[model samples]
Each structure stands twice: as C-alpha cells, then as structure tokens.
Target chain A: MAVTAQTTKLDARKLRADFPIFEQTFHGKPLAFLDSAASSQKPRQMLDAMREFYETSYANVHRGVYQLAERATAALEGSREKVRELLNAPAAREVIFVRNATEGLNLVAYAWGLNNLGPGDIVLVTELEHHSNWVPWQYMAKKTGAEFRMLPLDEHGELDLGALDEAADGGNVKVVATGLVSNSLGTINPVEKLVAWAHERGAIFVCDAAQAAPHMTVDVQALGCDFLAISGHKMCGPSGIGAVWGRAELLERMEPFLLGGHMIRSVRFEGTTWGELPHKFEAGTAPMAEAVGFAAAIDYLHGIGFDAISAHEHELVSYALDRLAEVPGLTTYGPPADRRAGIVSFNFDDIHPHDVAQILDLEGVAIRAGHHCCQPLMQKLGVAATNRASFYLYTLPEEIDQLVDGLHKVKKVFA
Target chain B: MSDGLDSLYREIILDHYKNPRGHGVIESADAEAEGQNPLCGDEVSIYVAFGEDGETIDEVKFSGRGCAISQAATSMLTEMVQGRTATEVATLDKDELLEEIGIPLTPVRLKCAMLGLTTLKVALHKAKGTPLPEGIAGFDELDLK
Candidate 1:
C-alpha cells in the first residue's frame, strides 16, 4: 500500500453512510468518535456478512459431513486465506485464527516459550510493548528460568536503537518481541532493522502488529520476522477474532499451545495425535461468524484501498496536532506526527485524563484515557495516564475540529 | 465551552485537585491500606488515625493522581470524616455528596467520584479489624447515588 499523502478532505457525509452507528445519537449529542485505537468502528459490509453467515449458512466446521457444515468449513478456511492475502503472508497455513492478539501472542509465549526457551535464555522486550506482549514473556521467564530484559525508549518516546542493537547483537537473547507500532505514543518501530538485529544474534523475532495492521500495510514476509500477531477488531473487523502469521516451517516446528476436541486428529484416553499445522492450535469450536466478519472487513478495506485510508488518517492526525498545538499548556506525547501513526496522546496542564475525557464526552466526543494497556510506557513517561484521540479511515477533520473544540471545553472545566 | 461545565468543575473540586488536603505520611496510624482502580489507573493510599476510642476517626489522608472527582471526593472525605465515627460516615449517603457538587455523572465517572468514600469505608474496617462487607467497594452501579 503506497500512501502518497492524500490532500483531499475526508467527506463525513459519505463516510458516515458506510458506518451505521453514526445514525444514533450518543447521550443526546451527535457522536464524534475518536477512540479507534481501542476498537475501530465496523462498516455495514462486515456486519451484513456476519448476519448473512448466521442466516444462510451456519454450522460447526470440520465435524460434520452435512452440506451446511461443508460450506461453513470452506468459508472459515477461506477467511484464513483472506487474512493471508491481507498481510501478504507467504502461505495460508501460517494464518492461525485466535480470539484476539492477546490470545495469539499468548499461544506463541506458551507453546514457543515452553519449547525454545529455558534457563539462561534471554527474551528481549521493549518499553512500548503492550502488556499482552510483555506479560506473557514475563510469565514464561518466571516459569522456564529465562531472563526477561527490556529495550529502553529514547528521549522522544521512540525505541533507542543503539540500546536495542547492543542487546540484540549481544548473543544472549533467544527471542525478541516488540510492537510494530507503539499503541500509546504511535511511534512506528524500525521492524525491518529490529528483525535483522534479532536474527544476527540467532534469536527469533516476533512483532506485535496490533497497532500497525490497522493503520498501515503489513507484509509479514517483507518484514522478515518469524511471526506477527494482530487483532481483527482493531482493523474494522468484529470482536472475538484475530490472526497470527508465521513462517510455514516455523509454525510446523512449534508445538501446539492449546489442546481440545478440534485440535486433534486422533485421541485416546491416554494421548492424542494433533491435526495439521493451523488446526492443531485451534482449540474448541472457533468464532465462525466472526471469521466471516473479518473477511468482510478485509473486503471493505480493500474497497476503499488501504493506502487512501492510511493517508486520510495521517492528514487528519497532522491537522489535529496543529490545532491542538494552539491550546495553551497542552503537551503532545510521542514522536512528531510525521513519524507516527494517527494515535495522539497528550496531557493538558492542571487537568487529569479522566476530566479531559469526561468533558469531551459531554461534548459527545469519545476518547480513550488511562494506561491504554501500556503501563510500562506510562511509568516511563512519568504520568499515570494521558487522554488519547485516535482516528480511523472513517474519521474526519470535522471530528478533529470537534476534538479541538472539546479541549477548550476541558480547559474551561478546570479553569 | 458552555455554562453546563461549571457544574462539573465546581470550585471545591478544582480546589482539591489543585491543592489536595491532608497529604503526606500519617505515621503510627491505627489502620492504613492502599486502593487503586486498575481500569483507570487511579490509586490512593489512605491512612486512618483511629484510636482505641474506636468510633471516632482521628484523621484520614490520601495521595494519588486522578480526576477531580477522585481527589475532590478525597478532600471532602477528610473534612467529612474528621472527628466522626467510622460508622457514621459509612452510613453517610453518597447522593448528598454529588448533590453538593451539583453535577450528575455518567456511570463510569461516578466510580471516580465515589472512589474516596469507598476506600474510606475499607480503611475504617481495617481500623476496627473487622471484615469488609461484600460489594462495599463497588456501589456506583445502583441509581441510589
């Protein structure tokens, strides 16, 4: 996806028609959404696809010989291929569906951690890692006696590459897991370089691409990482679905993380033989309708074109940063807008994050506040939380205007 | 900005957030415990200076960074609970406090508003060395407030 900086205005009237929820008023006020980083709003296409699946063809996959079951199985497997295409994954088998990025990362930590890492092994994480990516490794370190280390952030809230390179090239690291983009600060990490550094130390590199997949084009093969995890909900899909993309050979070599009925081909009271590569990890019945919804989400994005969507969001965030700069005593977090995605974290002098959010909500402007699943980043920034206004493809400059207008309201509340 | 914001940012609430009351360490206190909202990342370490005289709370102090609702509730709590018995404040109504602030809150914001009193109730129980009542820490769900 080549995003060449869209100069066109994002038409709210046209974009709002794609999202049905905009029709309803939230708290007796017109909703001005700005919380896409938390969970993106779904388009009608995705919702309609899920409803169609349930209404026309709904059955348990891979368990029955009935016609409906066969169709459901085909559709579920087809969604896996859609995800593979979406990420430019080399093979469809590398895409394993899971509950969300949290679950997908946990699978790698539990299965890969138990097999590859042991005493004296080191796993390198970073300050910008989401707790989902950080805590699982911490638990693995505690269980297997592997040392858990962190790559520090630079003064500008981006990764300190010199420090990361020193740790990565030190030869003590067995695995490296970091975010492709910072969810809190929106700093896009140098994944291409980080992957090379980790591989040089004979370590496997896994990227948490939850933030990156939603805002930019993701190519797992091009990224040259062993594995990448992303949630469907963040990318305009429904909840309860996500995918983990890994190299086919690596996934085949890794052990199964979760065990249940659908994961095994043959079972005895004492032991069981696992199924094929992807199915071996899918425990119980999967979120079938959700997988279909995810496919529709990819189709919806492809329709608008990912490059245009990303460029539109970039234009909006840049405009927002400029407008927010005019607010006195306001401090924006993370790297400058040019280097980051659309997520903007900031703090206003003499105002708490909750107050800012509450004031914004009164104006019908939705924003996210609190640790944002990055408590370590918050600790490093020396603040408990910051108010974040993140945008998606459907978000408009008018909404950014509303956010700027809302900040003035926030200042007045505390003034 | 609108005239409606004035109610939410009442003078007392801003005063407390700007200059919190009863800050610092309360040494040799009878009871002390820390409570934090992991959802919003707001924390408060409250120290209770209740004596063997029991019912009366000699002092209470809290330290945390949160919205005006939490800090204002804390500041008002220290003033409301000083020299009053633990039982009296526990029975004290939460609705009256919001009525004083004169701003209605959403379901989520009400928790920030009540975080102080809820923690105080727990600190009181710790002072008396009694079991905390079930669901005492979470009281914002009902419209009773």
Candidate 2:
C-alpha cells in the first residue's frame, strides 16, 4: 500500500457527525469531550451493529445446532478475526476474548505468571503502569512467593530503562510487564527495546496496549512481546469486551484460568478435557452483542485509517500544548508533544485538579482529574493528582480552544 | 461564571477558603481527628477543647488542604461548632453546614463538603468515647486516619 497525503489527514469536523453524542449539549453549551483516554464515544455504526445483531442473530454460540446459532457463532468468531487483524497477530485463536483489559492481564498473571514464576523469581514492571497492569503482577508475586520490582521513572516522567541492568542482573527476572503508553502522562514507552531487553534476560514481556492500540498501529510481531492486552471500550467499542493476544506456544502451555460451560471439550465422572486455544480461556457465555459492536468499531477505525487518526491527534496535541503554554502557571507533565500520543496532563497554578475539573465541567468540557489510577507515578511527580485532557479521531481543534478558554476561566475563578 | 458554578463557589465560600476561621491546631486540645477522601486526596483535621462544664465545646479549630468546598466547609464548621455542646455537635445535622455552603453538590463534591463535618463529629465521638452518630449516607466510608 502506497502512503498518500489524503490517507494521512483526518477531517475531524466531518467525523464528528458519525458520533451522535456530539449533538447533545452540556449546561446548554456544546459538549467538548476530552476524556477519550478513559473511554471513547461510540459511533452510530457500532451502536447499530450491536442493536441489529441482538435483534436478528442473537443465539447461544457454538452450542445450538441451528442456523441462527451458526450465524451467531460466525459473527462472534468474525470479531475474533477482526481483533487478530487489529493487533496484527498471526492467528485468530491466539486472541482470547476477556471482560476488559484488566481481566485480560489478570488471566495471564494467574494462568501464566503463577505457573512460570516462583521463589527467587522477579516480576519487574514500570512505574508508569496503570493500577490494572501493576496490581495484578503484585498479586501474582505474592501468590507465588516471587519478588516484585519496578522500573523507576526519570524526571521527565519517562521510564528509566537504564535501571533494568541492575534489576534484571542475576537473570532471575521471570516476567516484565509495562504499558505501551502511560495513561496519565502520555509517555510513549520504548516497548520494542524493552522487549529485546526482557528477552535477553530470558523473561517474557506483557504489553498493556489499553492506551496504545486505540491510537496507533500496534503490530505484535514488531513489538515482539509475549502477551498484549487491549480494551474494546477505549476504541469506540462497547464495554464488557476486550482481548489478550499471546504467543501460541505460551498460551497452549498455560492452564485455563476460568472453567465451566462453553470451554470444555468433554466432561465425565473421572475428568474433563478443555476446549481449544481461545475457548479454553473464555469461559461461560460469550459477549455476543458486544463482540458485534467491537467488530464494527474495528471497521470504523480502519475506515478512518490509523495513519490519519494519529496525524489528526498529533496536530491537536501540538496545538493544545502551544496554546496551553500561553496560560500562566500551567505545568504539563510528560515529554514533549512529539514523544507522546494525544493525551496532555497538567496542573494550573496552585489550583486543585478537582476545582479545575469542576469549572471546566460548567464550561461544557469533560476531562479527567484525580490520580488517574497511577498513584505511584503521582507520588513520584510530587503531586496528589493532575488534570488530563485526551483527544481522539473525532476531537476538534475548536474543542481545544474550549479547553483553553475554560482553563482561563479557572485561573480567573481562583484569582 | 454560570449560575450553578457561582452558587457552588459563592463569594462567602471562597472567602472562607481564602481566610479560614480558626484555621490552626490548639496546643492543648481535648480531642483531635483527621479525615481524608482517598479518591481525590482531600484531607482535613479537627481539634476540639471542651468547656469547664465538660459537655460544651469551648473551642474548635481545623487545618487542611483541599478544594474550595472541603476547606471552606471545614472553616465554616469550625465557627459553627464553637461554644456548642459536644453532644449537640455530635447529633448536629449535615444540612446545617450544607445550607451554609448554599449550593447543591454532586456526590463527589458532596464528600468534599462533608469532610469537615464528618471530621468534627469523629473528634467529638472520640472525645466522648461514644459510637459515631448514624444516618448519614456516604460518610462512613471516608478514611479518618
């Protein structure tokens, strides 16, 4: 495929028409949603697909021997194929449907981490990980009597990978987990290098792509990580649907974390055999309608090419940072705009983040406040919380203007 | 500012937040307790001194750092409880202070508005060696360490 300028520039104003939520108003003002990092607004295509699926093709998948069941099964499996393609995985069976990114990480932590990690083993993670990626490994280490370690962050909020030499020295590092993108600071981690470093130490790497996959082109083969997790809701899909893409050999060797109906090949008085690759991990009834929505979301993103999606956000963040610097007493966290994705985290003057969020809410701007579930990072940054404004494909430059205007209003309110 | 915001951050509230009343610790206090909203990191500490009657609160002071609502409400609470009995302060309604705030708050901000009153009540409960007064929804979960 040849790269063209047309394929790399997005019309955010036109794309806003596809999301109906934009039509609504907050406080009688047009809503400027800057919270896409938390969850993206669903497009009509995804909503229609889910509603249409439930109305027409709803049935128990892989069990009922009927036409509707076959169609439902095909639809759900089609989503797996979409997810596989989304992650650029080699096989669809390696992608296991999970509740969300958190559950996906937990599945790997319990199934793979518990089996592979033991005493004298180290599970190393980065300081920038969200609680989901950080807490599960802590729990796993506690359960298996393994030691837990963290890769500290530099003053610029980027991970200090240099520390890994001493941490992984002794070659006891069993597993290394990290987020490809820092959810709080918008720091784009050097995952490929980290993956190579982990492999050199004879360790498996887990990539939390919850923030990266939705915004960039993430290829599992290129990342060379053992497992990668993502949430559908963060990418304009419905909640309650996510996936974990793992290496086939590793997944095949790991025990199934959940058990019961739909994941059993045979059940008997003596013993029962588990189902095939992905089914062994996905227990109980599947999220049929949510899967349909997720497939549509994948199609929606593909329709607006990742190249254009990222380019549009790059423009927005660069513009936002430039305009934000004009506001006095505003300090932004993380590296420069070029080194980050579309997220911007900052604090204004001596004002509290909650107070800033409250004023912005009245201005019809929706952003996130508080620790953003990265308390360790916040403590390291010497702040209790921060105000975060994130962008996506549908976000407009005008909305950034709204955010800036709301910020000025905040300064005045406190002034 | 909009009507809703103006109401939430009334001039009186901002004044109290800027220049908090009784905003310090007592050298010799009868009871003291600290409260924090773990979610947002808002914190408040209350110190109380009993009157010679042993039932009346002779003086009350507070100190903390947080949003306008939390700090202002705590400042207002310190003034409202002074010269009141410990028993009366323990059973006092949250509405008394919320009305002083003069605005309706979201559940999260309501936690901020109530942080001061809750801490004051906790101090009274500890000083009296009595169980915390009941019937306030969403107040029990606050970490008072």
Which stretches of candidate 2 lie above 4 Å from their native place? A1-6, A169-171, A269-272, B26-30, B49-59, B85-87, B122-129, B133-145
Model 1 per-residue lDDT at B44:
78
Model 1 chain A is weakest, by summed lDDT over 10 consecutive residues, at A1-10
Q: Candidate 1 — which residues are off by over 4 angstroms?
A: A1-13, A165-171, B1-7, B51-55, B86-103, B122-127, B133-145
- Cα lDDT tens digits, model 2, A238-350, are 99999999999999999999999888899999999989999999899999999999999988898888888888888889999999999999999998988899999999987
Best by DockQ: 2
Candidate 1, residues A1-415: lDDT per residue as tens digits?
Answer: 3324344545646866989888888657888999999999988889999999999889999889999999999999989989999898888888999999999999899888888898778999999999999999999988999888899999999899888756644347998999998888889999999899889888899899999998788888889999899999998899999999878787888889988878888999998898897898988998999999999998877766667777877788799899999999999999987889989999999588988988888788999988898988889988888999999988878888888888887776676
- What C-alpha RMSD separates each model from the true structure? 4.1, 2.8
DockQ of 1: 0.58
Q: Name the top lDDT candidate.
A: 2
Q: Scoring only the second chain, what is candidate 2's TM-score?
A: 0.88
